[model samples]
Target: MDAPFSMYGPDFPFAYDHWLKHPEGLGRIPVNRHGAKVAIIGAGIAGLVCGYELMRMGLRPVFYESGQLGGRLRSASFEGAEHMIAELGGMRFPTSSRSFYHYLDLMNLKTAPFPNPLTPAAGSTVIELEGERFYAKTLSDLPPIFQEVAQAYDSALEEGAHFSSLQAAIQRRDPNAIKAIWNPLVKAWDERTFYDFITTSKAFRHLSFRHREIFGQVGFGTGGWDSDFSNTMLEILRVNVTACDTDQHLVIGGVEQLPKRLWSHEPEDLSYWPNGTSLQKLNQGAPRPGAAKLFRDPEGLYVTDRRGHTDRFDAIVCTCQSWLLTTAIDTQESLFSQPLWMALDRTRYMQSAKTFVMVDRPFWKDRHPETGEDLMSMTLTDRLTRGTYLFDHGPDQPGVMCLSYSWMSDALKVLPLDAEKRTELALSALSKIYPDVDIKSHIRSNPITVSWENDPNFLGAFKGALPGHYRYNHRMYGHFMQQTLSPDHKGVFLAGDDISWTPAWAEGAVQTALNAVWGVMNHFGGQSSLANPGPGDVYPVWGPIDLDELS
Candidate 1:
């Protein structure tokens, strides 16, 4: 029998070329061969990867950052305790992410197995429905009782496949099998809930509850919190680093070390300026401490520290978040008119909060019943204002238990609490999950909350596509370094997670940077000429164009 809950039916077409041939297929812009100078914005993983790629492709890049690098991969110290490294924004990766693995291997980093304790108790899953608790020893024990429900789900999936095939068949004017399958699948795909869809469809009624459980379990593993795919990717990134040709090396110290090391380069050709300084008063403005700006021209790119001083560079590469670019430039109205800008604006970012609590010892080890297994109990709360996940990150120090609580958008709305309130609420929620555990005496809660909505420089947590948004504007990937205005404007190119195939993740950011590097190579390799180049490209260098365009 076929594996349960497989969305891919035998009839489902697995053609990748369909995306390439679609009307919106990579909308690649012609390159400007004479363009040489380039600027990279953002210093996250995406920016770093792009810079590395550009440098390898025979281009000198001066990277800029409005804040510390590794944008969200930040760590913090509590009460003089050892600095605790936690991903403040993006966390984890999947093994199935091929590109990410390739980049990691290229970087030559090492990996460690993620800390998931092997125990028999880990296999159980709990589900809550209609104020009642349900437990399953294995996926086969799930409680979906209606026979027709399974058939409906299967039929819906089959119909979805039929629709795709039908559309293809219609082009040939073949109407024989169209009406029987196409309409039903379309209606099913529009379903609001899995339960509703499964119960209403045919060919799915005979599915056993065990089959549903297996499907649900696998789906959870693939897409849920402990997703194996994402976890594998993270392992690759954690261990891989690119070999340095010079004395310089790129290894994992702490994520913050990346920006600090880059800043230490102190490139002579580049000048730095403070955020509020004017170009005219480059030498006269008082330096602003801890804040710096970088400007590039023919003489070189300059990075000015808070106190307005300048360092110059022959070229610049920006690997920062795109949202920072939205704020740093003076001509917001004009820049916002670009198709890329509109695409960026339309991207939705989910609001999330993570709370790390350090408690005295593992209380659950002793409080459980004789039959209870050593497992992290995950509770799904009915309360609208509660946190979603509560899991252990293991004990780092004696009597210290690390617990993480994550709140998604819905939780953010109902609780409506600030950082401090959120911490209290999270603690309260944790109490509910472990009722007998003594939370008050040992709880050392240091909550970190990021409101992507409030950050002017980071507008939101990377980028997420809204409904129908991904289908139309998918081709924006190949236009990163396309010439705009004139030939001189060619030096400035966009680089960020928003430009990749998948937005809002580290993988997307890295891929976009790679695409940007290719764009730069194509533009400067002499395929197209523009009337004006940006300020950074006043002095032009000519190069031959042979790189493949990604359209």
Candidate 2:
């Protein structure tokens, strides 16, 4: 599918080569050089990418992961059968991830084209309003209010080159126009709910019932909720990376391979810190003299597991949930007071859930006898329940059907239900969509659910901007390097998805890593090039720098 707008066009200009330069070149404070040892916290996509870039730049980056790698790109297995991968956190990727594609080429991975459900299983959508189910297809199909909003949206999109332009047109109050369009679109985008936009915005007041229909039609038109921009990046990575093998698609096996390949070192030269010993070394290297002095140290960083072990690092790049960092550091006066840290804590995230249900038969294949179409349907329903979506698993598994039930915020509140209870609630909910099926029996026999809340490392799925949060902040996370007082600080730096233009996706992680590498190279006075070089040319084959002398 073509991108909605060209992110690389002149209007949205980006500097690739300039970004490849060192962070110090941008007049940012530089890190102090202690030993060449770099410590990376969190083995998720961001951590892995940063480590890969650091290793390529001749710095030894030791990665510390409290849990398994691929923090959010996690998967689960069924009852002793073929291990079906379920994206407990992030589920899809987008096509605009150019850097991600480049990295994939470097890694050597392949892609399996996702089946388009546009034809065979093309399901209709239904909106539950005032206890009535309304079929929502064309603009005219929705309630009158929604129809007017839909028309306004179509007009806005047609008249203006971009949404922002359309908004400007609305602000101008063209006499020829029938009604305002900006309020609805902006509200929907901000609230993630058309209803909220309509009820709250004064501009929507003049919209006729028919104009309002446009809101529902456009909102649920083509791409449903599960479709993510990150999927394209994944495909690019699959096609490009030589080191990445597709056969091993499991997160533990395949995704984890990225860091292992980057950190591919001889056993003799590597010091494995499975526990928290490495963190201790980072604390010891703190520039300040006392415990309070620890916070004053420029390289002061900390990583903690709920299990009680807390480790510090010289330069820490955390790619975990924004809220986790906020809550964890709330009581610590030192960390929260920092300007960068304070901004990060204020960021809000959207909540979502994914449920995987294994059915006794591929019930979706059966056609509705009356309608003569596939009985299965996928809908973006009111924010009433968790499982708002429905889809089929495809031909690979003939008789098995997998249903994904997702709800944004409301669902997250009651998540992490014990397995048995979760299965019971899921089956109960599935019965609403597939009323005829024996959901209880099917669920009793086979059922599974992935609750992000239960995940200790990742408190939620992905980071989403809350209402009014985006306006206050432009950059999603901190972008530049800071000066460290210690001699070792020069080589130490931070890289994570939470620290780049694109956040909460694999692409962000890749970009963050690239930025970190460029920052390090710039600090060390290395030349930047875009040539495609082999692993040996890109990364130093020699082992890590000696750390014994520095200690």
Candidate 3:
């Protein structure tokens, strides 16, 4: 499924390109809208995708970028070695993100299976905790205690949340069954946190504290759940039911390529601009400076850039991180209503950090002379360094290693250190796992590190909704259905992953951008045909459960 609780038939969930190609979707925009200008703030994927589709609908999109072109999908390369890149943001994407794959397929970007735990790509896994090391080539190779913990997790997913029933219902696209199973979940779990679900569930309650601690430190699919323990149960459920945590793949080179391609690619046939028109060309080969302030005028919405240059457009799509509206940009109070402003302001973002180093070779592949085990395939530990990943380019070519990947408290730990210091700290921690391997000797270049929480362009990595935040999420996610919104919110639309049902994923960003596109088209007197209605036309019937009534 594209999203856990989408209004669309579960089978048809997140078929974004299908909706765009449908006669009703394509025909919704009025011909008169041709040549009309729309301002898109932030050159991220959401903004770029929205602009790309809007241009196809015969509207001109002028863009504003405050920082680099590819917002959170950042990929940094070493000074001399450009081929070996370190992904600082959005490293892996699951297969369930079908809507996002549309762009990847369109771009013909290469991909390889990500080395998630127990996956084939992760040749082996080493779990280290409390001065003990356990190496496993597969899940079965682990000790019985670990196996029991994994089983308990699976059972909890089914018994506590009706995981199996819901999965079957979604597979069959049974709307009635979906509502029956999912609606109650929203009401019950919305007020609870992930930790609450784990501890309160009978399956986990029976286990010892050590078992629970191990489960928290080395989670099944990705790594750990401790970072997200305080987030709402609904958020974790969404990740599980939709399978966003498994069967993931990494974009070759970098995830940033998707948006960069959309920025320059010109669709076939004619719109108002011309056959060869693209967002890059429309903006005169570069985006206007970052939007510094926004205010409404008699003619339309006005945006003033950091350089004091101002531009006016009929409508504005604010795709920047929500926090920027309140902190970075000076937005007029009247632009959005108070409750909407509250929702935006309350959007909580999670902190994340990553440190990467290029090594002379894939020395990690060497078997430990004494243990007969591979030094480390993918390492997960409870040390200062949470997770470490190794990327083997080739046997001879230099390898890239993500020395340390952490979140929340762990992320904050290295915020004060520079790249060299961060590398030293990571190496010190990793030495405990592989004392025989001289990791420092294999290092070829200076390490690259990032603390997303400290980056000025993004206050934090992505939104992590807390318990009791459903009402706020409801307002933000449903803002595109114009009839339900106030007049003040009509001219300005929000489009970003943070506003979506599944935050921090590119699919959510794409889905919300499409919602904003439909809203903008409707604002200019567009309508979807009855037979092949756009997402907006069918959203009321198939959309998210109304938490307001439950409240």
C-alpha TM-scores of all predictions: 0.60, 0.63, 0.96
Tens-digit per-residue lDDT, 320-342, candidate 3: 99999989999999988888899
Q: Which scores higher on lDDT, 1 or 3?
A: 3
- The CA root-mean-square deviation of candidate 2, after full C-alpha superposition on the true structure, stands at 11.8
lDDT-sorted candidate list, best first: 3, 2, 1
Candidate 2: minimum summed lDDT over ten consecutive residues — where?
287-296
- On a 0 to 100 scale, what is the lDDT of residue 452 in model 3? 81
The numbered model that scores best in lDDT is 3
User: For model 2, how does the per-residue alpha-carbon lDDT over 151-180 read when each residue is reduced to its tens digit?
Assistant: 554443333223354333323323122113
Candidate no. 2 TM-score: 0.63
Q: Least lDDT summed over 10 consecutive residues: which range in candidate 1? A: 237-246
lDDT of 1 at 205: 48
Candidate with best TM-score = 3
**Which ten contiguous residues of candidate 3 have the minimum total lDDT?**
4-13
lDDT by residue for model 1 over 110-202, one digit each (tens)? 333222211122333344433454444443454555223334433554443443464444333233344344333323232133433333445
